[model samples]
Target: MGRRKPNETMRLLVATFIGIVLGFFLGVSFPTLSLTKLNLPSSLFPSIDLTYIEDKYSGLSTQALLNAWSSLQGKDGSAAEINEFNESRIWVPTNPRGAERLPPGIIASESDFYLRRLWGSPDEDLKMRPKYLVTFTVGYEQRKNIDAAIKKFSEDFTIVLFHYDGRTTEWDEYEWSKNAIHISAPKQTKWWYAKRFLHPDIVAAYDYIFIWDEDLGVEHFNAEKYLRLVKKHGLEISQPGLEPNNGLTWQMTKRREDSEVHKDTEEKPGWCSDPHLPPCAGFVEIMAPVFSRNAWRCVWHMIQNDLVHGWGLDFALRRCVEPAHEKIGVVDAQWIVHQSVPSLGNQVRPKALIALGLSFIDMVFTSLSFKSCQGKAESGKAPWEGVRERCRKEWRMFQERMSSAERAYYVSLGIDPPNSTTAR
Candidate 1:
């Protein structure tokens, strides 16, 4: 073939360079853009499939997408690994002191009637019964009660106690019980305490992991029946603690418009019939959620968030549970009384201010991006209408909610609400 003309060669080179520059800029700027839209020619970008490219770069570190998987992997021995247990059931007892607070009558009733019926009746279809009961004790005062409860239940199931406290010197106390596993919660945030103490190794000991807050008392609680329900429903992440008064309590009202619409059809089943609505199957309060080994493993991978204190539980739950497309079942059959009632004390005011400030920042960022993108599209500078509309709606909601949350937090903190000038 004859050599290309000098002008032709220059034009080809310039076009290739421009394409590369555009791809890099688009990838960096609109990091959330779906990879399918890249529409990269297969021949030129043969090594990278645009569809799969998003997974590889979905939470690219520099883009601030917060790669949860990456964060988990960065921790020592904390890479997301799946381990399964052969036994279908695991029993969990809250630490002794927490259990002691439970009504003795209620506990006895569950142990005699509910626990036995479930464990005794073998499912002919599944041909297995839940065998192990795991209990965790944190403070010294609760250990005695926990140990006694475990001993009482030892005949029906394998009772295991997981103890954690850096100050404890009696490591040998648990040596007698083959069922018990002792671990320490290093002086760290409650978030890390759960992660490290509730490590995958301990979780791998059974198929179904029951994470019970110590204060829960089983009253008409049938462990076998609950497991059967979990198995029947094929629940990956399940909760059997407190049920919401109404579904409206669970509704994420402040999400972006598209998100709200999508949630209506996808996440939630019903439309907002009334402007003042309650949540349908409201958010899970994480007090006594049970995870199939799979769910625990998936959630475990997301525990290493930047929020060191316990404040990020809800945020992490939303991120992990929502993305997995798993439903959190609030079991109304049995209710666990939460002993340590959450209160907004001295630090609450500061935390509220911080949350409001962050919300404001998020709103501003989302709004500016949406408005500019929408304006460009309207001005015929961009061709993608769907992208622009979605961005605009999301930003608008963010702006509105951020302002509202800031005001509410300030009022709760006994401070003057920020004016538009302060907001700026």
Candidate 2:
């Protein structure tokens, strides 16, 4: 090629720069001025903003833009649309961690997805037809009680065992144990498992939830019949009436033959403030209470991680439902024996025992009292005075912890705890 005159070359360069500037201005003024915003097929310009292209394309994705581009060029729009949708599919990313917008904490964790796959499909017949759901927080020591509790439920119910005390595989030694889903983590309380796995929404398909202690004697408790009574009475939060002879059983839980369900019980003098309040009204011991699907959604959040024993939760259970004196109650016709034997309390290792500054007896009392016993400890302590003192101390600390947590949760929700009268 022959070299042009210097003046001509300079003039050509100036004209080219003006044209580039004009193109840039046009691109900014309109959405579809550039090839980058065309099909977006090559992914070479993935950063290109298709949303800025036109008013009609404002909400259309890059893939949608590609579909339009492909259609304009007489290509199949369906193929392009499929490719775009596939590109937007969300997946767990462990490696390029922040590469995608992750699911929030309230949603199921990524681990739950993978853990579910390993569990294979649920029982085919019970797939979505679980009439009831039962969760038992248990240890190897209460094997008998746990077995009895399972027998009360019909096969239509889905049974899940939350094994604490670190003996995860011990239950596998037995044949029947293999039938129920066993989720084990050392020292995790029943409420802990419930928080993570049994969120109310997760079990919405079930008609009722029986969150029970491992030691309930179901000699007279019929799961299906109890559910019938719950439905008939419209009881949202309830427990089977306790056999009056069951040692350590509260008077309110005692079964009365006259009625099918009862919401209030006579309390000891000076023990309760209102006749229509829990212990007196709307109360079910945490050990054997059953919750309907909708009610549990509220109660689940009320449970605190640190207060795994659920000590004060029974009193607060009324908060989840209205007319605490009416909606929550006890099914007198179907009662369970609160077997007081506490095996997990005495089953701790030497290492944990020394670290907690608890003697074997204290551990037994603490475990059964704190997070140890769900319904009632298998047996009451000798010298009820000693057990009473421990309970008083534990309960005091528990209330403090819950109060602090309540304040923090409210603050997170942008409310002043002291000023806000509503529960979190």
Candidate 3:
């Protein structure tokens, strides 16, 4: 309880001043120094590195660090993941508006094909953007059919062509082909072309997307009228009904003389598990399907990058729209004939051709000659056969992938997947 003398108080004040000066020098010399790293006992000394955790994850954004921390603690990272609508998730160091990454010019914009003039203002460059997008996966052999199909669509639609024959200049003979967007890749299927070229964001401005095969006969179809009828029925996914007599696989997609639109039909007994499912309802053949913007966005994501044939996609299209039986249907009033030309199917080399022992050049010439003559293989055992067999294999593969993916997703949520019998 006794008070200290002048000499003791002076010594204590000098020691405190020296300690403060030494601490400042140490901070400047080793900014990263931390009491935690030195194995110091926390009970003996006050914790000096308040930002140890922050410095450990210095380069990570706050959201990313939170996600990692949650994962380490056995928590669902999804809870800490960025929400789609959270504007603060964006980060731009130079932005005047905090968390706004995209500049005005770089903000979301729809893609278009209108040629802009170098001298004109961008506003005046395009009088109007096309409202619909029509794409055809074609071969030069089907030029006439494709020309006829393009004639059915009005100027309000943008024409895009995916040529599998490596022939673009030859299409210039058709007046509309000059204005059309042409992409050439030899021997690629329609779905392959679609997956690469028709990204949902790229075609977001269009109200509808028409992805059709070049073999379709559009003599009875009118694009504008078809769209009008589609909108009237609130159809988000549709296809012009195939002429009932030709190349019809599903009863749901077959043209009905009695109705303008058909969403459901009585298919063969066990083909569909539910009357509201595919081959009975909510179905459209991939050959000539049309999709609304929102539906296409979902469908685009559903498309498997490697599944070029799109065999099982017809059944899965129902998942993109609600009340599948209501929003998916066939426009019976606007019917098209599926010619089943098998142009791409003919790309397969027949066993007979291989057995002939002809040189590669000779085989090429012989194949071209055979294709010119209706492209049918002898005894149904060649070209088209191989293609058809491959399609069946792809269908099985696609179904397995979808089932596995669904099962994995359910497992991740700690839930058992429903039985196949009850899954429908």
Model 2: clashing residue pairs?
31-53, 277-281, 287-374, 287-375, 340-377, 340-378, 340-379, 341-378, 367-372
In model 2, how large is the Cα lDDT of residue 192? 71
Error of 1 at 28 (Å): 43
Per-residue lDDT of model 3, residues 35-143, tens digit only: 3456766667465554554343344554554454555565354633434324444455454433245565565445665557788677887777889999997788788
Better of 1 and 2 by lDDT: 2
After superposing candidate 3, which stretches have Cα over 4 Å from the reference?
Answer: 1-101, 345-381, 421-424
- Residue 338, candidate 3: how far off, in angstroms? 0.8
The lDDT leader among the candidates is: 3
Please provide, for model 1 over 1-424, each residue's C-alpha lDDT reduced to its tens digit, 9 standing for 90 to 100.
Answer: 9999999999999999999999878766755767587676678877776865554445344344334334445455332231121121122234233343354445532121112334544543333333444444344445554444344333334333334335354534754354344445542333444575566555464566565444334443555656666666555555554322311123332222221011111234443332222122223434455666666667777554433333223323433444332344444443433333111111122223344454543332322222112122345533223333444454354445546766999999999995521111
lDDT of each: 0.43, 0.69, 0.76
Per-model TM-score versus the true fold:
0.38, 0.61, 0.70
Q: Candidate 2: misplaced stretches above 4 Å?
A: 1-128, 168-175, 347-367, 370-424
Count of backbone collisions within predicted model 1: 15
